[model samples]
Target: LEAYQKFVFEEDRLRSVQIAHHICSLMQRGNVVVRWKLYHSVFNPVLQRGVKLAHHCQHSSVTSAQMHSCPHHDQCLPQEVLQVYLKTLPALLKS
Candidate 1:
């Protein structure tokens, strides 16, 4: 039971990380409405998954103490990509 739970947690975390990266890529090329839709459709779910992963890590006895050591903890979108996205978000929202 513990092993399976850990596996599922890791799987979800990896998938969420991939989605985060994809969202950044889409933001780089898509227009305002497209980005807006993608944010609502895709990014929200990834955010939820991240929240779930964090909760799981916090609750899991095997991981509670080592939460910060998890590789996936830092696997989300890169800083530069996120900065670019933030810079464009205001312009996109205005349009």
Candidate 2:
């Protein structure tokens, strides 16, 4: 938790998706309060951010055993193939 806090607060970084996913992962690890806070405050906003960024992306629908990976989905510059992976991605949060 302290490492996450450092990456967020100390570094003045707002990695909303990572932070939200981490909190969700903690919830999956069985923390009632963290789950409550994530559902109440964090989840939707991160998805919204992904949706906004997806506009600049292609919204891929291709089927392949190994799919495309976009490293810079967090940015807004146009690219040939920008995969906007979000929280709702099939079983992303599954362990």
Candidate 3:
């Protein structure tokens, strides 16, 4: 039973990590609205799953570390992506 539970937990963690990476890749392209949509559609659900799994495991630190280290955690902020988006918008809007 313990081993089965461990396998399930690891599988959930792996899925969460994969989702985070997918979010990062999507964010690297597209406009602000597109990125925000991807966040809502993709990132938030996975994040909720991770939270639930962490809560169930009663080891918040285990998931927290993985969440923090996700590339999106560092790069998901508006200030980071928006600056680049804004700079390119002028050219895009002109075309």
- Top-scoring candidate (lDDT): 1
| Model 3: per-residue Cα lDDT over 12-86, one tens digit each | 545434444444555556678866675566544444544455454354343444654544443222222223333
Query: lDDT of each structure?
Result: 0.51, 0.42, 0.43
Give me the displacement of residue 62 in model 2, in angstroms.
17
**Model 2 misses residue 53 by how many Å?**
0.7
Candidate 2: stretches off by over 4 Å: 1-21, 31-33, 58-95
RMSD from true fold, candidate 1: 9.4
Reference-based TM-score of each model: 0.44, 0.38, 0.40
Scored against the true structure, residue 28 in model 1 reaches a CA lDDT of 60
Of candidate 2, the 10-residue stretch with the lowest lDDT total is 76-85
Model 1, which residues run further than 4 Å from truth? 1-20, 64-95
Error of 2 at 31 (Å): 5.2
Candidate 2 structure lDDT: 0.42
The stretch of ten residues in a row with the least summed lDDT in candidate 1 is 1-10
Q: Candidate 1 residues 1-95, lDDT tens each?
A: 22322332243545534444555667667887877676766544445555556565666643544655666555433333334335555654565
